[model samples]
Target: MSEVIWWKRGVIYQIYPRSYQDSNGDGIGDLNGIASRLDYLAGLGVDAIWISPFYPSPMADFGYDISDYCDVDPIFGTLQDFDRLVERAHGLGLKVILDFVPNHSSDQHPWFRESRSSRSNPKRDWYIWRDPAPDGGLPNNWVSNFGGSAWEFDASTGQYYYHAFLKEQPDLNWRNPEVREAMHEALRFWMRYGVDGFRVDVMWHLMKDEAFRDDPPNPGYREGWPDVQRVLQVNSADRPEVHEVVRGLRRVLDEFPDRVLIGEIYLPIERLVTYYGEDLSGAHLPFNFQLINAQWNAPTLASLIAEYEAALPPGGWPNWVLGNHDQKRIAARVGEEQARVAGMLLLTLRGTPTMYYGDELGIGAVTIPPDAVQDPWEKNEPGLGFNRDPQRTPMQWCPGEQAGFSSTKPWLPLSDHFREANVETLSKDPRSILSLYRALIAFRVQRPALRLGDLRLLPCGERVLAYERRLGDDRITVALNLSSEGQVVELSSRESHRVILSTYLDRQTEVATATVTLRPNEGIIIAA
Candidate 1:
């Protein structure tokens, strides 16, 4: 078989700029800090790095509220610094995927300022603004993702602007040709650097209902749930017109070769697959977050993976996301033992795998102090279980104060387990989480079947999730015991096999039978 695209064949490591590393002893992380860790990341065996938004912002929603689309924020670093980091990343044979936020811009943005200056401004149409309803209320019943009404009343302009998130992030009018053109140009600005591609932020929110209609109530919504779920969201997000916008973005992305477009879309498998476009022309990969919400069990995970595999469009490629910046870490959700199993499952699966920063070290969420809380979701709702600060803590680099992430106090607190669970400490231990990740990544690189193969589920008991990856004659079977009790798994191929690697890292025995026993919570990969 011929070689496939880099993204399709290797793992993508996500770096949250503010928490990755700090070079100048400032409490906040900077661009130079990220540049300083290139060697460490390269050693981690990731094919590419996807950095979250580091653009100029007002700190309302962290960097998600972009004030400038063309430049990096000073807290992170200068454009030249970013350029240098990209150069270094490429030199180390690593690709860079920047976070492109298109749904909204910071309220302080020049376009937004001018758009809100007056109703007759030339750029007024760049953002979505509407007259109050007949009773001088919000134009519609849409709700914001961060908890209030989606429309913010502007006392100065006597008009209301729409914001899917914080009011500071005014939604752009994608229906406006000029807005689309400007956003496309933003994509071009990054492309000029010959970077890999973009991970478009809130891809599903790019388009909204054209008629300014009210969203119906959701049957699934409970009175105490987040207000965003109170409505069906039919008119607020995931509109059919989003496909056209994705196609338009795809056209610009296709102008450059081997550059991928990964849309940050959160939808069911059926709707999620459509982002691949009718001809797979939309996003190169629409991040599959099924695992994030799936129950951590053998039968449940097996069904989720198979369902996602079967839902892909004709030429669509699959990608798996175990953890991300928005949600809790894999270790925090599924336990440390299972995080190792998750690493194995993610790497050996049929699609691309993205590892959240510090996940390889089994980093879980840290408790944020009430006074140190920064997430707007937490601030807005207070106790609605919407805070994201716990997952955005500083990385544990070494066994030192501040975890060697910064010389000064970090912007957010570090986990108490930093001393015990850090790169410097784990790199020396054979059975460490970091070691297992490196081994799994290296093994996947050398074995073509594991990287690119067809998946076949094996017959197993309730406690085991088993499957085989086959690429011609080279076939490898994987059996994972999700429960604490041991279980016997029956393999379809009754051939002689050798254990390539195990979670325990000490079980490399040979097998020549159709059935095998997995020790409690153990996962193994066997080659025949």
Candidate 2:
């Protein structure tokens, strides 16, 4: 058998730097701030940290619209601070993963600046620029993931450039070998600084159809859905040629040992698994976000997990994420009680699990005041409920002023319940959600069955989701009560079982009967 990889067995904690901590009192978290909290993360039992984009940007889409790929944003500190952060994280035996946004460059980027300068400029081909349609409208029917047309007209150059997201973020022309080389070099630049890996942003949008064909209108489009979803992005994203770009990225990471490449793909399980590429040469893990959007019910989740497990490529590894910067918090989506069950579910899953920074503390969405609205998505498509500001709020560290996230106010508002739901206060509580997360992560680390075992979905009722993870004699069963009521899951085996951990953090080593009686909104891990 091949040697197990850290990214495969260990948990990854995602820290949105803008909200994690603020060391310089600038109301923004920085690399130095993250470095200071390494001990907290280490104690949380997560194996790695995936920091969101902190590279130089004009803040168009926050840091996602990167202007300089090789350096840190001044607001987040300098390249030296990043190096020290990696060093500190390594000292704590923690791996570091950075978010790589390659699909687009900020309109303020020098490359895009030159590209939009003149039609005959040397860098004009670096971006996806095209002549206007005969109707003098959009180059194609492509819609921006943010809203409206994906093409931004550059009157100075007399052409339109494509942007999968905001118009300020112009898509890079990956078909150009020069652009590919430059982006690959950017990866190497960070790898040399001891960065462990990257979670590639918009991995499927790297390559668009060469012919710039119009995307087909979605037959299932609803009246209130986001404008981007009104049309199927058939020509604008997930193109077959994107695999070649992924393989090239894999080659770049393969030049170094044990470096992981995770693709931020929002496709279906079948299409998402294809990102592993032919012969497993593509991304190491195409992020499985099914749980993020899936209905919070046993039947739906059970089928989703089973289908995802069955869809993995030969050596493809699986990963799970319940919440992130872009979506509603798990706690908000499933309520505070179910979030603990969700934590247990995430950590005990067969493959890697990524814990969103504040989710461990049961931090849900914050009410973003209209005067403080910051997310470009919410601004671009107003009143459509596209606001992500609630989920991207400052991390709740303590009950002190500003929730101990910063000396002053944070870039975004803090949650209303931050005083009660914070790491400082909850860490001392034996039954707190933070305690549950720490216990779950530690439990997963100590159990081989939970770490690298093959999963077998067990028979269970509609309100319960049960699965067994086994590697030889080492076997563990995880059953979660997905609803708000009590659930009893029958066991197939007559062998005695011991309760290893529970979401409430109250039970341990208790022998189980023929059936496991789960409290409302609870999850348990049993050892047989």
- List ranges where model 2 is wrong by over 4 Å: 1-3
Best by lDDT: 2
What is the alpha-carbon lDDT for the whole of candidate 1?
0.90
- Lowest lDDT block of 10, candidate 2: 1-10
Candidate 1 stretches with Cα past 4 Å from truth are none
Which pairs of residues have clashing backbones in candidate 2? none
lDDT of 1 by residue, 226-324 (tens): 889989888889999999999999999888889999999989899889899888879999999999989999899999888998999887788999988
Worst 10 residues of 1 by lDDT: 506-515
Report every candidate's CA lDDT.
0.90, 0.92
Q: Write one digit per residue (lDDT tens) for candidate 2, span 1-528.
A: 136889988999999999999999989999999999999999988889999999999998889999999998999999999999999999999999999999998999999999888888999999999999999987889998988988888888789989899999999999999999999999999999999999999999999999989999999999889999989998999999999999999999999999999999999898999999999999998999999999999999999999998999888888999889999999999998999989889988889998898998898868999999999999998898989999889888899999988998788989889999998899889989888888888888787888899999987889999999998888988999998899888877788889989888877988876888999999999987
Per-model RMSD to reference: 1.1, 1.2
TM accuracy, model 1: 0.98
